[model samples]
Target: MPKRYIVEVDGVPPSPSPISNAVVVGNQCWISGQLSVGDDGAYVPGSAREEASRAFAHVFRIAEAAGFSRSDIVYVDLAFIDLADVKEVNGLFGELFPEGRRPARTVYQAAKLPFGGRIKVQAVAPR
Candidate 1:
């Protein structure tokens, strides 16, 4: 059995809730839901693409903090206020993850998100 450790990235705002940003056991890391919020915990206002990019940035940063490579990310769980933004968010995802090296993703139309964000993302990595 491997020891589990919580991961925290510097410059990322700490969550006001009790949730751990991420947890790692052995080679795998499960990053909690991340939003497009700045270090001040304020939502970064922008289009869905921009917001998704920031969300993805937060996920990758947390993954990196756990010693996982960006390309090594194995899964992602995305939540969106609108399903219409999937294509746009996918465009940004493709740009970041690339085609040949993409993670398995599940997208959902969320009723509402924390911080009133239009988008949120959670990730699992190191497959």
Candidate 2:
């Protein structure tokens, strides 16, 4: 079996729940869902676009901790409380991944999210 390792970024705040921010096994890194919480553990208040941006920033932070970049991401899973927020989220996604390098993504309308966040994002990346 491949060894598994837990990964955490320095500047990111710990989750209130018991969860590793990310985990690495073999050549793959699995990042946990990230909300729009700040390093101070406060949920940032803003529009869907702002919240989504913050969540993605946390995802990138975890990816970096696992020795990967956003471009190295192979898949992304997003949960949004409002389906209409997808347009805003997609803009950020495009900015992060660009045209030809976008990762496979799945977006869903979640019934609710932790911390009253509008969006949550999780990613898988090559380590």
Which parts of model 1 are misplaced by more than 4 Å? Answer: none
Q: Taking the tens digit of each residue's C-alpha lDDT, what string does model 1 give over 23-89?
A: 9988789999999999898888889998988888888888888888799888999999999999988
lDDT of 2 by residue, 1-127 (tens): 9989999788888899999999999899999999999889889979988988888899998899889998999999999999998997788788888989999989899998998888989999985
Off by over 4 Å in 2: none
124 Cα displacement, candidate 2 (Å): 0.3
**Quality of model 1 by C-alpha lDDT:** 0.88
Worst 10 residues of 1 by lDDT: 11-20
Cα TM-score of candidate 2: 0.96
Best by TM-score: 2
- Taken over the whole model, the C-alpha lDDT of each candidate is 0.88, 0.90
Quality of model 2 by C-alpha lDDT: 0.90
